[model samples]
Target: MESGKKGGSMESEKKMLESNSILETIPRDLVLEILVPLASSSLSDICNTKRSCKTLNELGNNSYVLRYVSLEGVEVVQWEPSPELLSFLPRCEESGNPEALYRRGMVEYFCNNKHEDALKFLERATNLGHEEAAYVLGIILLCNKDESKEWGIELLNKVEKRKRSRNIGLSELRNKCKAIVRKIWLNNVVCPEEPLCSTLACKNNKRKRGQGWDLSDEDEQVMFDCKACKWDHERTLFHNMLCGSA
Candidate 1:
């Protein structure tokens, strides 16, 4: 019975050694690379893995990993940013992580409509070579009637050049930018008048009256009336410019 117990212990020791060897063989960078695509929930499981691998634990808490998981994972579900993810944003911002900045800008813009914060983060991300951030910020600037329009056009042009050279990922964003640019050029030809709610009083009047125009009827009238307002096209562009395809 003692011999049997000793044999069992020896086997367990061998198994433990083998597991440690396997863990050690997997490079930390490779582990981090694999973890980048995983969701926060998966990373939680990895952190709970029955091993004392400090690298694995570190990867689970890495700012870049948290940002990627939050942007790709929870953002799709229309949920608030996870606490674990939000906790890393400051670190990422301090580190000047472009992707993290972009994600934070998106959260602020979409969730809170805090345009100033969104623009600040997005501009930093863009300056740091984040193409998506540049594209988004450019579009936002394009929609505004301010000095930023020139900067917006410049940013879009830069992105266009980059896309032509690389042309991978961000296909939807590229298409949207193309459509927006084309629409901007078309504006010169169409000379569409500004919507009635451009002014504060007009907006307040609109609020009291509720959605002042019938876009569908106006759109139908455009076919017959050469002078009909391009309300449908303007409305569509307005929505797309602000909301984005995210």
Candidate 2:
């Protein structure tokens, strides 16, 4: 009777070992697919599991899994791409993944301030029909005050048209872009020289010309161009009224 009981115990242990081995042998991609839909909290628990659950923890590090969690608004540690994700970036870019390109552009723009690199990646993503990427690129271009402003406006208009055609609600990002464009159009005042003034009064002052007015307080009199009292009166008015001085 004792020998038969020991034999049964050995058989159960062997089956358990086989089951664990099978779980370890499952493909990584399949594991990731299964884990992607799990809640971030649950995923965090899995990552914190015992050393014996190393396979489960490793699946938590998969790029697709991490990206899905990010999209779900989960605050994963090192929420940005890890070395593993960076390693797969080239492959994803070659595969024409718009999200990958967008992510790369955002990292360059926000982290490194590499506008050119960000523009290159974001442009590629936008060309591939990534609306969010287009919105971001458009805003960046609009703020640049260079040749890119036209292209930025063009992209923003395209996005607006697409949204209208699809009957989609307007996004806050689109609204912000529209507001910026409107502000630029409404305030189309020009500065005469490189050293621009901060206030609208200074910018619109007709008496000011070529950079700024030269003010002097010699003999308790303010002077603009040393042309007698006319210059002094104008300078004093500018200093006392516009500049808020006594």
Q: After superposition, how far is residue 166 of candidate 2 from its true place, in Å?
A: 2.5
Candidate 2 regions exceeding 4 Å error are: 1-83, 172-246
**Candidates' RMSD to native:** 11.2, 15.9
Give all candidates' CA lDDT scores: 0.56, 0.52
lDDT of 2 by residue, 1-246 (tens): 999999998888776667557778888778777776662335344345412354665566555565444222221113466775555456556555566677666556645567789789989989889787787776566555467656766786687568768776334443432333332212221111222223334432334443444433223222323222232232233223212211
For 1-246, candidate 1 gives per-residue lDDT tens digits of 999999998998787677667867888678777777663345345446424445455666675565544333223223466676565557657667676687667666655667899799989999989887897787567666667756866786687568757754334564544443332212211122343234444433343245554332322222212111222233334454443433
On lDDT, the leading prediction is 1
Tell me the deviation in Å of residue 124 in model 1: 1.8
Q: Which residue runs does candidate 1 get wrong by more than 4 Å?
A: 1-52, 59-71, 76-83, 167-171, 174-246
Clashing pairs in 2: none
Instruction: List pairs with backbone clashes in candidate 1.
Output: none
**Cα lDDT for residue 57, model 2?**
52
